[model samples]
Target: MRRYPEIGKFTLKVYYEKDPEVRADIQKSIAKYADFKQNVKQLNFDSSQFVPGIDIEMMYNDMYWASEGYIWEKIQDEKYDVDMMERDFLKMVDFWKSIYLRKEGEHDEGN
Candidate 1:
């Protein structure tokens, strides 16, 4: 699992290319799934910072079918669904692992 240095307050950052068509499509899709505004460029879910909590951040890219994204959380205890935390941790690990492996001539293994 991957861990980032704690930043005091929980914050999620999503980055995407600036594209109008792609941005519009993402807005429409999110609106269809939930009550979201068309102009909403960013979304934040505020939840308890205690252990076993999740925070989601989403971003859209004009040229990519899957939106680029990230999630950040502070895990404290195992009383909650720590599996979710582990999953997120693995995702973060996989991201950097892939990059490093690629640069080091190691097999990406279908990554």
Candidate 2:
């Protein structure tokens, strides 16, 4: 809650791949979502509320890695997983994104 630090300031310290192409893409995302990410990070919510009792920073970083792991996955598509079980901010974000997409689809159908 109010006692917790902002999520962005949590310093997930996610690392970018050394490959130029991958690094570039990640950078682009980082830039495009800088404000969004920063704002999310700044929210004074307890990381524990969503994520498990594990190290919050590790879990947050894991979410970022998993979400952006398309390169290692040979995905050539979207990225998104990781080793943590407890729900985290990214999980909530993904959940919300799903809702938004679902609603959008519904609206399209309605139209």
- C-alpha root-mean-square deviation, candidate 1: 16.7
How many steric overlaps does candidate 1 have? 0
> How well does model 2 score by local distance difference test?
0.45
| Candidate 2 similarity to native, TM-score | 0.31
TM-score of 1: 0.23
Q: Using TM-score as the measure, which candidate wins?
A: 2
TM-scores across all candidates?
Answer: 0.23, 0.31
**How many collisions per candidate?**
0, 4
Off by over 4 Å in 1: 1-72, 75-80, 103-111
Model 2 worst lDDT run, 10 consecutive residues = 77-86
Please write out the lDDT profile of model 2 over residues 27-87, one tens digit for every residue: 7777744344565667666543442234544545555565555324522322222223224
Candidate 1 per-residue C-alpha lDDT over 1-111 given as tens digits, one digit per residue, 9 for 90 to 100: 224323312222111214776667656655543433433344443222211221122222221222222222232331334456568657766664443223444333454
lDDT scores for all predictions? 0.36, 0.45
